[model samples]
Target: MSLVSYTKALNRALGDALAADEAVCVFGEDVGAGLAGMTLGLQSRFGAQRVVDTPLSEQAFTSVGIGAALAGRRPVIELQIPSLLYLVFEQLANQAHKFSLMTGGQARVSLTVVVPGSGSRAGWAGQHSDQPYSLFAHVGIKTVVPATPSDAYGLLTSAIADDDPVVLFAPAAALGVREDVTAPLGPVPLGSARIRRPGRDVTVVAVGHLVHDALWAAQELAGEVDVEVLDPRTLYPFDFPALARSLRRTGRLVVLDDANRSCGFAAEVLASAVEAVPLLAPPRRVTRPDGTVLPFALDLDRALQPGRDQLLDAIRSVMA
Candidate 1:
């Protein structure tokens, strides 16, 4: 039990998994050298064979992971940048994702791709600031966006242990979050939601780092409104039942997501809530603009992304 940073939690989780399972392996750019903070010192600890560094070809290396998975090895790929996900979409979506279903459950793609810094990272701008967790969720692949140091550790551990390919988006905005570890945190079940702030006025469903932002907004509006903040740790296989319970209690919903609005994950949550649960008013969502490519300018970047004020406005609108 100790204070742990979000990134450090990830490092510890990977380290623990590598230690526990002889079949678990890590392959990525600069992973051996620990260029990505999450893989820091892991290569030397696990050895070169298990934590192998690959070439610059995302497609090739991703296919290699699928091959390893087919051969009964658990592979974890670290894509230094979020946008690199687009490069291996074919390998991940078409091949590894379909193996088990195509073969009638004869194969298992026990693979996990960890994106250390997802979403807008200050000056990273367009190419580097992609938050594509929705893309994976849309394709039926397991996707997780952990917001807390503990969740980051627990979810990643679960993803690595799952018998499927999982993409983990470690939000850049959430990497700095530190939590007091009073006890040993265990693996959090996938498709579960965490009630960060319980309230009676409204249910604010926040994804990834926005969970923290939602908490902040809830505190700011403490006396005026009781805003409940819910974090859906795994975007796909969403825990709608827990959300329904919260919505039933609050009678209102607001989704705060980092992706673009059109066909975004938040839109799906809002639509599903109205269909499956009772709501007093139309659900609201605070998200990036449709067809948006974030600008590099500091002000522009902040303007394009969802923030606490947006969550506050959305919560107020839903209550109205």
Candidate 2:
């Protein structure tokens, strides 16, 4: 078995895709230099044409990706910062995402929008530190958040191969996670939920990087309660059936997400679990305060984000 960091795993996936398929290409700012490390060495191996570096126009390049995808080419657009999604929302959500349906299945946009560093990065503050997966999910765009190195590789492969537009968020908090792999890396199907830890008392639904916090919280509370950790790798077209099954076994739920409390991913999970499944008690969700804007100060920034302590408390409250 070999150990690999999450960032390297992403780079490996991009390299593998470029080599495996002639139709696959990548475009972004500084892609030639691979400033994010995820696209490192890609330009050298794939050549400048396939590994393109666009001008500082996100809106223009984002639409260019959509156009390329519509022309039967699989284009992966890399956004160094997550907030850039907001700038090109119309291009992605309206243009790329709606092409297939709008044209009555005449077109399939195989475009993948990759955000390397999503969520808070200590002092990144308000603009650069937005976890906007929920926004994409709400608009019915395929959204994925892979927690481990293996999943990062597998999910990106699947995203590139998908017929519809897909958004892959590599949370900044999870970039450091490393894993040991004995098997050859492969695609992990979209809309699948993996059970990180099995238990019978309460099931904790964690999104993006919060999966680690959920697992740690589960272990910390192991003696007092049996906690199950469920990582819904794909947030949109969510694996609700799997979550429903877990809720059936645990009879309780607690969601840990990085997005804001109001209309966030956690709220959707909590609402769906309650409405579609039987719950022994009210569900709990640990997330940023409603309509939160992360502050510039270190302590104030940390205060705006969810943590293990908050997740543990929520689980305890739900279980009580």
Q: Model 1: which ten-residue window has the lowest total lDDT?
A: 311-320
**Tens digits of per-residue lDDT for model 1 on 92-170?**
9999999999999999899999999999998988999989999999999999999999999999999999999999999
Worst 10 residues of 2 by lDDT: 90-99
lDDT for residue 196 in candidate 1, whole number 0-100? 93
What is candidate 2's lDDT per residue for 102-121, written digit by digit as tens? 99999999999999999899
After best superposition, candidate 2 residue 270: deviation in angstroms?
1.1
Collision pairs in model 1 = none
Cα deviation in Å at residue 232, candidate 1?
Answer: 0.3
TM-score, each model?
0.99, 0.99
Task: Name the best candidate (by lDDT).
Answer: 2
Clashes of 1: 0
Residue-level lDDT for 260 in candidate 2: 88
- TM-score of candidate 2 on Cα atoms, chains taken together: 0.99
